[model samples]
Target: MSDNNEYQGRIVVITGASSGFGRGTALELAKRGASVVLAARSPEALTELAQECETAGGRAMAVPTDVSDRNAVAALTDKAVARFGRIDVWINGAGVAAVGRFDQVPLEDHEQVIRTDLLGVTYGSHHAMSHFRARGKGTLINIASALGKIPTPLYASYVASKFGVVGLGDALRQELGEEKITDIRVCTVMPMAHETEFFEHAGNYTGKKAVPIPPTYDPKTTIDELVRLVVEPEDEVITGWQGGPFSFLHRLMPKAIEKLMAGNTNAVQMGESMPAPKTSGIIHQPSKA
Candidate 1:
């Protein structure tokens, strides 16, 4: 049994809590005794997850929020603070991706990816950092993807957004230290593809064919990693042993990695022919709300 007593009286805000990792993480954290604030654009889904949290003997609030809007995100932070005295952990799990050759994809999709993935994380971090600063302590967990480290074809925009997330988180850590805000920590959780509607809902700018990865995750794995991020916020956390190796190879041999990326099927559009999302760089965005 894991000890969830640490968050007994804390508050956690999770974006994109409707489905995928966000929903999983919300349930996991709530079970750990944290009062969770669930934010997602889909009111019904968010409410359902909130109900699950409540039934699990955990305190939770459902806030209908769209991460793409800065104001809405700020309002969520305000509401969280109003309900709970302080914000302990703010998770930016909302993200969107598109699968297509760059030339075949639309620029709107690139914009959408940027707005939802990069902008959403930034908004969450900005709002939460303020709250943490006021309280003098907290953790900001940004849900990123393995693609951030190992980019693959057909997801240039997605890769670009995640890279921005990783870079921003790193810089924020340094800046926080410089500012003497030692208690406020920053972490980025990078997970490989999990069983979710991520691909189905992902923006498909490329009219060329798009396919779905066969489902294969237990969903509990996401819960496990998310629990870790809350209980022990580290500089970065990466799941999926396979993806971990890809990260290593990418850094150890840039040229080899590049060649491998061009020829590899990691980011290939999943089809009925594909087994699952296991080997792909596609990951569930926690904040694609």
Candidate 2:
């Protein structure tokens, strides 16, 4: 249960609402009395999630959307406004990844990860900012990863996309400050590896079962931070207990941190994991699982 009055009268739009942090956040906000607009590639999943949100005691709208498509993202915004009047918050939580040695993963997989993760955030941020500018207030939350600050092996494209997200958030904040837009906030959330369907959906060519790095925290930890951000927006937030220290270490010793992370990923994702056949996962299409 949540404090129903905390988010009363608020409307939030969440991409990748079918699963992972996006879904968890939506449900939590809904329980707190926020109207949630859900967007994801799978219509069925979105529909189901919408029902769950409503059942949890808040309004919900399911919009089948591919965030990679600018037009689809625009339409998602339009639809949310049509039903809810305006969006108080927009969360760009949609992302995808391909895990393997950079060259071994298909060029198409790498391109798709960029298109969905990086470009999708760009599209969502563009529309959210436009709306915020019109209303003179709103919060844009971009869900980046710890990898954005400390690059690691086995996730080249994901790292690149998350780095872009972090940079994008920083630039947006700078522009807002320069323009004296005090009410509009741009926040980036960087969370360490956590238990989520993200790994299940990632394209894997590592010849080993894809698993989250060790010391993975529960998804709830990251979800709680996201919910808190909606109430108290910050320029940047690093969730998970390990995220802060790891990022700090990287800042102090970039080369050593990088080498250590590469070895850690290899040990956990390759050496410790079971053998598996290569599969494209969900990079090119929606997951059927």
Cα error of candidate 1 at position 19, Å: 0.5
| Tens-place lDDT digits, model 1, residues 1-289 | 3577886877889997888888888887777778999998877788889999988868999999888889999899989989987899999988878777777666766777788899999999999998888888889999888778777777888899998999999999999888887789999887776767776676564443445332235556666877787868789877665667768888889789777765653444533233433221223233334
Inter-residue clash pairs, candidate 1: 93-286, 93-287, 94-286, 94-287, 94-288, 95-287, 95-288
Best by lDDT: 2
**Scored by Cα lDDT, where does model 1 land?**
0.78
Please state the error at residue 205 of candidate 2 in Å: 0.3
Query: Which residue pairs collide, candidate 2?
Result: none
lDDT of 2 by residue, 119-228 (tens): 99999999999999999999999999998898888899999999999999999999999998999999999999899998888899999989998789899998988887
**Local lDDT at 187 for model 2:** 92
Candidate 2 residue runs with Cα over 4 Å from true position: 1-4
User: Model 1, clash count?
Assistant: 7
Q: Give the TM-score of candidate 2.
A: 0.98
